[model samples]
Target: MTQIQPASFRDAPFREAQFMPVTLDVERRNDGTVILRSRVELGEYEPNLAQAFTKTAERCGAKPALAVRNSDENWEYTSYADLKHSVDAATQWLIDNVPRGGVMVMMISNGLTAATMTFAAYAAGVILCPVSTTFGLTGGDHVRLRHVLAKTRPDVIVLESNPKLAAAVVSCAGDDVAIITTDTQTVNRRAFSLSSVLATTPTSAVVKAIANIDPENTVSYMLTSGSTGLPKIVPQSMAATAACGQQALVAIGRAADWGGVIVDWLPWHHAAGASVLRSTLLQGGTLYVDDGKPLPGLFDQTIRNLREIPIAYFSNVPLGYSMLVEAMEQDPLLRRTFFSKMRLMLYGGAGLQQHVFDRLQEFAVAETGYRIHMTTGYGMTETVTGCMVIHYPTEQVGIGLPTPGLEVKLVPQDARFAVRLRGPNVMRGYLDEPEKNMEVFDEEGFYRTGDLAVFSDANNPEKGLVFAGRQSEEFKLSNGTWVYGGSLRAALLEALDPLVSEVVLCDDDREFLTLLAWPTAHASDQPLGTIVNRLRDFNRTQQGASAIIRRVALLDQPPNVDAQEISDKGTINRRAVIDGRHEIVSRLYAAEPDDGIGIV
Candidate 1:
């Protein structure tokens, strides 16, 4: 077995941190473009696997599945017949190439091969594992690539031939592992060209064989964003992904077949991206694959795409919404179509900026005359999809009440903590590491979500959960009134009212609460008096155990990347935040109590 170290993967793209988890398969990814040169045996779930596949395929057949925008957006589609045929050919291809489930590692951009391989792997019975091209794009991604490869022990590595990654892939590959190039025009070292075979393969008999496999067996392996550690190789049961779509449909107050067209790009490696694709395919929904990156250039293009297509729903990160609100406010026709037929506008990945929320609310009042459903969907790759979703018309940023059939328990995050979830969607445990697996679920088997939250209304239990920050953000003070950093952070976000991007609460057990804010663009250049007045107003109506910002320091840096302060996934390491502002923190405490004349 080969192992990759932290140093080799140190400066990886997407995340900059130490790598963890040793995947058994290291070489190839299941890019759906290949013909499986293997067997299609019904290892298990023989009873209902065909039925579920039929149902899922039938759903896909009703609508044309359009993936990748611009050039690769093949409006051309395959019916249930075609999907089955493609699956069959791909399965046969896998068997012919590397039978008996040798891992096919896929490290490519988000496009057809990355998308289609998901179904083909299930058809071929090969272990389908995909890695983020983050390493190739940014270089340091090998830390995760190494970790995933080591743990998974893949036999064949399939990669896109990009000039930048050519040297790195060769340098990083382990011996005996085959490297295949897809659509990139170069083939070497047991390499197979993807497009060449797709044009010639016969899939009729292959799809017939795949009918025997069970739905519960591992279909594909997805990795997390690895904000905390290395990206974990998360497996989803075929049943779980399908069920998640059913639950998400219910959460959105729409029929399973409600004219859904998903618009947003959240990266395919994580839960949000994969689930959106699944949800659309299962519901016969059209997916407008947005080229937006949540940053200005990409997201602006998304808005343009939305206007062209009759998008039924839009989902993205907090930054995306903030930028989108600016776009909506700028255009009148865009605003009309934005709210029209738009049943769900979902936010996940990270916290929604309060400013974005306010602008959305304001936009609803002006454009549609009624507020549309604004929601927060929550889950990890381990759960296969979001276990909870904030329902529409529910104000504030909530992860929403638990989806039907899911159970949630408030595990004490810190002394003042309250957030955890468990259910059918919970993962079937990690790849290995029993000790670590044991920590994920409790005595009752609820998945321990490390988030902190407040009951939306202390009076109303069923409303939803309001996310505070992470538990470690809690800071105690001389007063012993444990400042709930999560609650304080929420209050700061609430207090700023649609002003800041994301809030990081500062409490070192100090005398008062200080805020390290990542400001929203619209609120960027506002006057100091206006900001001070806003905080003072917030303090007026503030209540117990929550925070009242004594002072707010707007941090100019983007979300901590390079894992120096925050990881690539945007989870602020509280330690990084506090230490980075040591001197400022000291001064805040020294002047906490009436700076002039001790309250004279």
Candidate 2:
């Protein structure tokens, strides 16, 4: 077995911080399956999420719990004490209106109001469901939104006072369901304003409702990204949610001690973003709800926000970091302010390119003379967030190990292992879909993640696992050679660095591999010959028919969110894109490639 050596960062200064000690117990079964679990116990955790909020309120009363940018571009903060008051009032309203086990669907973005209602629903023993704003506001038939409404049968829907959202909900939701908004005037339906809900006087019933919350009961219904099919509802129990937070706290250490200020734009509808929100609240840290996204014309806001906030922890997708690296190369102040107090940096949603990772470290060393710890994790919505994370300091990019209270089962599949998770953090099953639930879990009750991984160092299990690709996305060529889409996409992105923002592989049962890519803003101006030369360089280094690309097409159009081509987390659905752009794929495979297509 060839040993994998850790990347050398001898010149980079080491900034010290406490992280969970690495400890693992491995069990290799006769069936060629390996079970890995942390020997460190989960210890004690607060199962009631409301109690976590209440504790933070009591401990950090005057501190800013949440902040959002105003129209003037200045941040407006809501103090913990004020937030607690609003939560209690909203809890009272929930108890008086919705049933104890009823569902409250929130269609709003991350903000003060969203945070207040989230904790209120927790306190009131109501299951809160948050969906992507794009489902309601983006131009489509609202199929995903309609499907969610039909599945959960929510008792109430909370949203901003936008007529578009209100009309969408009114059309899909039942008449019996109540509509709650920030303002009722703009809503065509009879809705109650959030101010009225916050004005309710808390009674003893509010306390009783809090006391009645069952940790084992479903507290939230998180929607899957629907990359493979229609979105499925994953029922998250309070125990699972609390367990995930506790696991993170144990693994990553206390964020409060690490300077607990975060600026994030990840939508709360997804697991990673929701984990950020919950973990911040549990740690008694302040969060700035960023309105800016990683897209063009919007990331400027993120840069502006970062200039003012000296954050300790930062997280974003790889594209965001790429953009940041470009901006920081030109602006020295942005780099200084960003790296000044940052202790840890995290990237997720997709595999981060090695060049992006290296560039970020270079910036960190240049700014602070030390490398900020960067890591990634492996998990899904079914697990409520990441159960396996890279907590240790290493230059190697891989999902480190299972957190406390979690067990990972690795079943061999081809050259990789199919990762299955069994943990307190794992959800019981999908909401109201028994057949689908039965299909997802193994006989021993592990959630089949459908993700593939291999040991980064096969001789050293402690080095943890590196993501190989999605088992579902791997397809065989007509020559019977299997192509791993995920890892290939990562390689393609890295090889074509600063040229293509995203690429989709398109050679399932074809003679040769081809790709559909969206070019970076800078690369868009380059001549077609430039892209062809890069592909030639890439193809020269690659061996075998499954690895080399024969043709490529650079698309001017971005991935359409409405068509399910891209998810809320900015991950492209490979199947969706191939099907949606069938015409383009055919042209790339034509007997004579068009002038627009680049051939190597």
Candidate 3:
């Protein structure tokens, strides 16, 4: 038996390894403002994502690349060679149907078929667009999808076996757009079956076209969550996408002899999922598709799958990890298997509560006699996935240092610094948004992140940056004091653990702040008196209005997904929740507060 040693960033072996090199340029202006830019040396490897996948497949020809549960509830495997072949076949079909520069929008489940089509779109040189399937087929959700369809004007639209999603895409699609689905029973005469197309062989001409694809061209057009407004299309270049995958591979620090395994259910629509997909392919690792999400009804599926497969590494949002912690606490076998082969655990998208972090450490020590390294990074769709990563092992909550091929600049913004980034991994600009794009970057060419951050220590950058809310999310009180929502939310969640699932403060031009709290499952089980006492204790420890949650109304329903109150990535949109639930908020701030409202 051999012991698997984890990779450390400070090790001599790691420091000497030749990955891509990024040159950082710094300039100081007379006005005391500084600018930063990072340029990558591009001669080390192939820039095209499909070409990189092809090379990886050649290296791991017979290795299992994709695994999915079949209709008979058996795990079906697709080898690297099989995956490449399927992608090529799908690419041929896409070439015949969609012209160059055309958009191909997909509303599909996370499975082998969906993964195959995504790569095929890349190989065929069409701009692939992925939208959230969590958007149910009604009201605002439906309207939002229609807006995406209208904005992208996709030449081809692919839907999963889901009838609801198929109906939504069909209704929104233009008459000339080709509608495709995996459901054989689909009644639409014009809608083509994906299975039939995948069975065909690639023509020589189609193969030639695939080889002719520009390595630096835009391969994907990802849609923003539109939590603030309508969704914007971000065009991500092939080089940028590939750079992210390579950076992740370098961070994982697995030796060449080491292969990896993952059981992931993150939606492919988000950059997080794409990063995992690319890294898996780049490393020639096996990916087991889990059809479950972190939500109550679906998380059982994730647990069932994990019971069968042992993963080398895993990543999920804070809510998912919180739920998993509860399950692992009660089930020792689950905990043992979870930490058995795992190298690292990663969480991102929002601030992870400290209690959740502590619980994971507790379970890790109990199961494996050692604490598993858990960390997270920070980035958006604009940066492809992550620019700053915790490449080294640490339990602290900072976003970590900038990865190779990227530069992070902190500029003064209000009381905090705005995090601006420049790198090969960053997107060129949003599609059809020239003016908006112009406003995002400075003369020195750094993209404004709209995020505020403060370094853990001013003198030491190695300590990393702490997230202070988004500039757009902050609001001013009537007394002209500004409130940072992210900091407040993180503090409240940490101090009042197991009581609140989420908190959104409403204090714009108000005398005192009010909060709309979404209670955790544990909190609901407790008596109202007990919950009020917890809030009281938390408030007494705080100093000012921004820190104290004055009045709170526990939400009767979860944050509405359709109304953009909560994103698919498990992040609450504070502005959307406030706007959509104004009536409930008004009640919380009434002259005579409602009986349901609790005051500190």
Q: Point to the candidate with the largest lDDT.
A: 2
Candidate 3 per-residue lDDT over residues 387-431, each given as its tens digit: 776655455688776766677777876667788888888888898
**Residue 388 displacement (Å), model 2:** 0.7
Candidate 3 global lDDT: 0.76
lDDT against the true structure, per candidate, is 0.60, 0.85, 0.76
Per-candidate clash tally: 49, 0, 0
Tens-digit lDDT string for candidate 1 (29-52): 243111111111112222233344
Q: Which window of ten consecutive residues has the lowest lDDT sum in model 1? A: 33-42
- Model 3's TM-score against the true structure: 0.90
- RMSD of candidate 3 to the true fold? 4.6
Identify the superior model by TM-score, candidate 1 or candidate 3.
3
Error of 1 at 332 (Å): 1.5
Clashes of 2: 0
